[model samples]
Target: MMFEGFLFVIHLFLHTYCQLQVVAQCFINLLRWWRVNKWNADIFLNQTKNLGKIPGHVSLMFLEEDTPVEDIVKPIVWCICLGVTTISLYDYYGRLRSKKLDIDKELREYYSDFTKNCRNSPKNQPSPRIQFVSVENGRTDLVYAARDIAQDLLNGVVKEVTKVNYQNYHKVFRNDHPDLMMKFGIHTTLAGYPPWPVHLTEIISLPTCHMISPYNFLDCLNRYFKIEKRVGK
Candidate 1:
């Protein structure tokens, strides 16, 4: 009985110590977040000059359900303002996919502010394109691509199996694979994002995205540009 009591006391102490450590880490993270100043298009424009390269196609993956549409749209607008040509907004489920019109409406509103505040004319920027990709879309794209390839083969359109490459598949979908994927979640796993497209994509995991500030967005971009991709070397 005494030995059991002593073991219980040790367990209690360890649990309390772990809880305190978690709290201390949270406090440190909060302090770091507070130190990052909010940025705008003007700041982004300046930062772009210093950046080595910008991702032409970027994907924002939201793992959490019920994420506010504004939270999703704000980053898209920022990406546009920063001159990303294409953007993909992905959620684990198809909830956001059905809300495409709503997201577009919100994007336009946010974009107007970016144009107004930015020194460079919006006309000078490449027209930004966006897609709402869900888990279903990933599966559907693969299945449909296979079906199409099979049909084309039967019709003698595709001469060789080797011809059915990623380029052809991507052309069928009319979407470019993401160059950089930003996953907004505390969870480590990607929650089963389409494997084929992101084979060579750069992925950065972030905390649960609420109102994503420009500082956080630009910080991700900075991290992406810093990576040295030694492909097949």
Candidate 2:
């Protein structure tokens, strides 16, 4: 069991480390190579060019230095990944332990025990609603990034509520979630317009993917802007 737990830890950390690296790489690339004309977006280049080939040999151009060396120098990526995995493992373990404890608790012996289902019934569902205050669909990546940033603002609590003001939630979403770009259902290269995806149908059918759920607000907005942009092009 301990060995299994250790392996789980290693896996979780590596995953997060990889994710961070990917996010960092994509962000840098977007700032540099992803511009309208492959512009030299060298914001960091000017800041650290004088630092020399030390301090893990970090580079502003493409982080090419440390990544290759990390593979040899104790495999830093793996270490970081392991660390992330350890935290995830502990969190899951704690939750499981709590659930097990709850299950093991002795029932009220001499009193009538009533078990109540905690789930919200059909009537408790949020009304079928779509609120799109704004939409921008120039690039799916940009839209995806915005959605991620918006979602993160709620810090997972957004999963339960409605009505969002970006001021309160922008930090949580920011560039943290690259996976959100994946949620748009297609990877759009900047060369030209990407082929229309069938998933757009679901968006068009009712302007939402998950019934009356609010998760698709920004998602739909993204598509809306993308469509308009394509038409304007």
Candidate 3:
């Protein structure tokens, strides 16, 4: 009778152990499922949020002194597809004007090929107006800024006119300011972008410009949206 009792206790213990093992496995699976579902949900929510918000204007600055204009065309096209109305590309070296003919030729070829290949080409949609500016333009604006300050002083526009008045006058040359500006290079410096437009603009730095993908452009837009801009308010 004692031997039978011992056998019965052993069986009970084995059964309990098996049940515990099953429970532990189930718990682990449940945790994995929860994590996977949560990750998928977060991705879906982010995509939905980005779709609702689109920047009106975007700007790109090539921090490197002699960046080729050809390297910028793809990024500009990607920005246009994102529904940007205005795009300003700035290069510190001012070589863009010299390469204008080559850039124009390449752009025309790209447009032709894009219309032929892309089934949902943005050609039918409103395209962004692209403008190229240089550090020289910003320097020239300093002269305008000085002139405006003198005029404001002479006319007594305000009791105490400061740098803000000068910035306001500098806007006359280019009215459409960048909503978001991305600097392409190792560093985050503006490299002489006009100060007036950047007061409210969000700036981001990209590692490089060569062989940049559309996803990189989208990532910059995403980063822009994630920031909270006070605009000195």
Per-candidate TM equals 0.76, 0.17, 0.63
RMSD (CA, Å), candidate 2 to true, equals 25.1
Task: Please give the lDDT score for candidate 1.
Answer: 0.75
lDDT of 1 by residue, 1-233 (tens): 99999999999999999999999989966764553234556766776777877788898999887887767887787778667898887877768878988888987776676566557645577687777777766677778778888888899987766633634764222547688999998888867677777877899988977757777887888889888764535
For candidate 3, the TM-score is 0.63
Whole-model Cα lDDT of every candidate shown, in order: 0.75, 0.27, 0.68
Model 1 TM: 0.76
Candidate 1: residue 143 lDDT (0-100): 86
Per-residue alpha-carbon lDDT of candidate 2 for residues 131-184, written as tens digits (9 for 90 to 100) = 111112224535664676666666864554333443243322221211111111
Q: Which ten residues in a row have the lowest lDDT in candidate 2?
A: 84-93
At residue 139, what lDDT does model 3 achieve? 70
- Winner on TM-score (2 vs 3): 3
* Top lDDT hit: 1
User: How many clashes does each candidate structure show, in the order listed?
Assistant: 0, 9, 0
The parts of candidate 3 lying over 4 Å away from their true place are 1-50, 145-173
How accurate locally is residue 163 in candidate 1, as Cα lDDT from 0 to 100? Answer: 39
Cα displacement (Å) at residue 89, model 3: 1.1
